[model samples]
Target: MKHTLYKHIQEGKTTGKKSFAVLVDPDKVNEATTEQLVSLALDAKVDYFFVGGSLVISHNLDECIRQIKVSCSVPVVIFPGSHSQISRYADAILYLSLISGRNPELLIGQHVISAPTIKKSGLEVMPTGYMVIDGGAPTTVSYISNTAPLPADKADIAMCTAMAGEMLGMKLIFMDAGSGAKNPVSIAMIEKVSSHIEVPLIVGGGITNPEKAYLNCRSGADIVVVGNAIEKDASLIRELSDAIHSVPVRV
Candidate 1:
């Protein structure tokens, strides 16, 4: 693995720079919209393109990734929902383990099944500890994984889970509130978890506006991912990216 994408992330963390990733749910966007999003991203100089979703039933993953690669040089990372979500067209894969939930499948079971294939695919495998925090509603991830999210207000739990993930050798820590979250992950939660972890912290879900995206970065999120918001309004991409990049590099 070249570790190109991971190196970019690591450098950002080391330099206190913030990144903005556009989460593209293949099931939601068609070819035309994807082109539009890629064009906007190219103009915005977006940091990364996260392609996947909890329930991507449309079978558009490969083409979606191919389209992004064709349109821009930005790295495309597969945010797989399951073992079946692998694709050779992507630049990297977030090998996620659901540390926040007790589900064996998400934690290790699916990884076991996907490991060999992932290894052969040549996608830079980023071992990510994925935490699902309560987003003030029942999310598809909670239902599909059959696991409950950590309580929204429980910063202690979030912090400990992230620390455990880092200790367990996770290359990155991602805390998501799930798609279309009623409330984004609290700034307090991001602060507590990021302060304790050495790895880069990624925060996503329900971040709709530039202010919220910027706040998430200021609070310690190395990467702020936005999907549902962009699905509704692609124009928000530039503004959101600007907001995140506007955060002063931490000293």
Candidate 2:
């Protein structure tokens, strides 16, 4: 399967319909919890499940993915924080490059060591440019990646980075306001970056409510991801889904 998720994104782009994805951090939630979330997610009609964390201290990933697949119909893609997070059962993996960071390790070093194994996993690989925008907190992704996020006000820099990612043949561009961010990526930043990139733009991190999600879509984010907020209240899944699907404004 050559990452059908990308095709779904493209179709959304062509149709001007927004997409919603739920990010599940294995280290934060358990199997039982995951199963419950699956039911909620199904009802919410989420487009995808992103599994992984900056530091995957949990061993339940394989079981978690298996359980989620059995109950959920949406594609489960691995949003790996480390190469070890790969699960063969996943529909695909985001082959990420931290384009906003200057660290060689994240830029290509890690990919070098994990390439051979990934090629054999039979998992669809989607090359993604990952950018961490200042989310008002120093989150684990920033700490672990050993890179500082671009200032939220620097729309020009974010735009250039995203454009660079597209020029380098990336299939998608992901802008994350680090987990538990007090503030989500600014709408201006989203607009600046999205307007400059042809590939799908996924905005996540600190999206606490439907209003924020709606504004993001209006700002040109093709896909909006909700994670931390949903964990606090599973019911937000349905509301978020409605917000993303009910309003399909193209910016």
Candidate 3:
């Protein structure tokens, strides 16, 4: 089967609808908890399930993905933090390049190391430019990657970085504020980048409610991802899905 990430985004574009993605971090949840979360996400009509985290402390990634795939019908996309996170069972991988930081390791080094395996696995490779914005708190991604985030207040710099990624042939742009962020990316910054980028835009981190998700959609985020929030209250999945899907698309 083809990766559902591309299919879901295409479907959203065709229907003039926004997409909802639920992120699953293996390091954060155990087997039983992960299964329950996947079931809840599917029941809530989540458009896609993104697996992977900054730290895959557990070696059960493959098994985790396999179990989740069997339990849910939604597409599972690997939002890998490193090349080690790749698995054939996933429908696709967000071949990410961290654009906000100057660290060459995340920008291209990791991609080069994993390219052959990724190609051989036949997983859909969605080239995504990952941009991290300062979210007021230190996130695991920042600490582990050894990179600094772009200033949240600097829209111009963020725009430039996103444009560079686009020029580099990236298919998508993901602006993250980090998991459990103190504050999410500002609407002003999202608007600035979304207005300039033609590719799909995904925003995540620190979004705790449907209202924030709705704000992101209105500000032009093609997809809104919620992880910690849903981890706390799986029931919020339905509310978030409804909120994102209810946004009025521009005619």
For 13-69, candidate 3 gives per-residue lDDT tens digits of 555689899998887778788878877787778888899999998887888889888
Candidate number that wins on lDDT, 1 or 2: 1
TM-scores for candidates 1 onward, in order: 0.98, 0.97, 0.95
Give the least accurate 10-residue stretch of model 2, judged by summed lDDT: 242-251
Full-model lDDT for every candidate:
0.95, 0.90, 0.88
TM-score of 3: 0.95
Using lDDT as the measure, what is the rank order of every candidate, best first?
1, 2, 3
Whole-structure CA lDDT of model 1: 0.95
Write the residue-wise lDDT of candidate 1 on 1-251 in tens digits: 67988998999999999999999999998989999999999899899999998988998999999989988889999999999999999999999999999999999999999999999999999999999999998899999999999999999999999999999999999999999999999999999999999999999998999999999999999999999999899999999989999998867
lDDT of 1 at 169: 98
For candidate 1, give the lDDT of residue 233: 93
Task: List runs of model 3 lying over 4 Å from the truth.
Answer: 1-4
10 residues in a row with least lDDT, candidate 3? 1-10
List the candidates ranked by TM-score, beginning with the highest. 1, 2, 3
